[model samples]
Target: MNESNRKRGVLSPCAACKLLRRRCAQDCVFAPYFPAEEPHKFANIHRVFGASNVSKMLQELPEHQREDAVSSMVYEANARVRDPVYGCVGAISSLQQQIDLLQTQLALAQAEVVHLRVRQNASYSSSNSHGGFYAASPSNSGSPPTTLPASSRGKAIYNMDMVFDQANMGYPIW
Candidate 1:
């Protein structure tokens, strides 16, 4: 009768009625309909040629193809799962600070080594001039060296006979 009613075919509804401003009738799920709509060009083409179609084709394939498809999916998932997880910015920055601290310590150690080397060279230069820094080698000089045997349990041997020499030093008239 009217332009809107004439467009209403045997219970097919418009996109607007089906989706929004919900109202329904017995014949159509959503009323106030339109009919003989042309299919969306891109959506139809995608349905025929896209990944969904490819997946369907794979599903209908032989056993080896199906296994290959599943394995590829699993491999992709594993790669995503096993990827090295990066820490947050703060953690990474803290690690960098630790590295910087270690580098500074290394530099300090290197400087100390250089200082020690310089001191060693200075001592070597002064060794003959000043009789510097006694090294306890039996071949060179000095008093008898003390050595500990395995049986000596951290005790030093003192010569008590020298301490008692005063007693024997008294008058010897005989």
Candidate 2:
């Protein structure tokens, strides 16, 4: 009614009226949910579900549920437009497959790390020589070959385990 809000003013026609080529009533059902700027969004919806059917469906729903129903229809319509054969299900299946692959890859990486750690620990326990993954101290490796204190040996293994856990899991184990 105001001068600024005249025909096709800042308020463009709702998508349904624009598509249907008619005046959008003051109480147009589509106005609140589908704005004029997003013509394609409603176009996709209209293409998938006919205008009359959409109107009837919206009318059947309670006021509170209409917004959610509109959103679901729009999403499904878009998905159907993208992939007519399988629609949203195709997209969901593809994402699930990718997740499954990444999980398998993570499992393999974890197992390989555990296997390497076991071998390295075995070498550390068996070797008198200093040349191993868990290196002996220079003082112990050299001529006198002094035995390490119990606490020192425990700390070395603990440190190695901590490093291994951090590398594999992105956090300290203990």
| Highest TM-score model number | 2
Q: How well is each residue in 1-174 modelled by candidate 2, as lDDT tens digits?
A: 422463435566788989989888767788778877778878988999999899999999998999999999999999999999899999999999999879767755665675555445445564555453344444224223334556656443322332233456554342
| Residues 55-152, model 1: lDDT tens digits | 46455777556555544443443333434243244455678999987976665555455444444444444453446554544332343323334574
C-alpha RMSD of candidate 1 = 26.7
* Regions of candidate 1 where Cα sits further than 4 Å from its true position: 1-87, 130-174
**Residue 131 displacement in candidate 1 (angstroms):** 6.9
After superposing all C-alphas onto the true structure, candidate 2 shows an RMSD in angstroms of: 8.7
Q: In candidate 2, which residue pairs clash?
A: none
Q: For candidate 1, give the lDDT of residue 118.
A: 44
Please give the lDDT score at residue 57 for candidate 2.
Answer: 92
Clashes of each: 0, 0
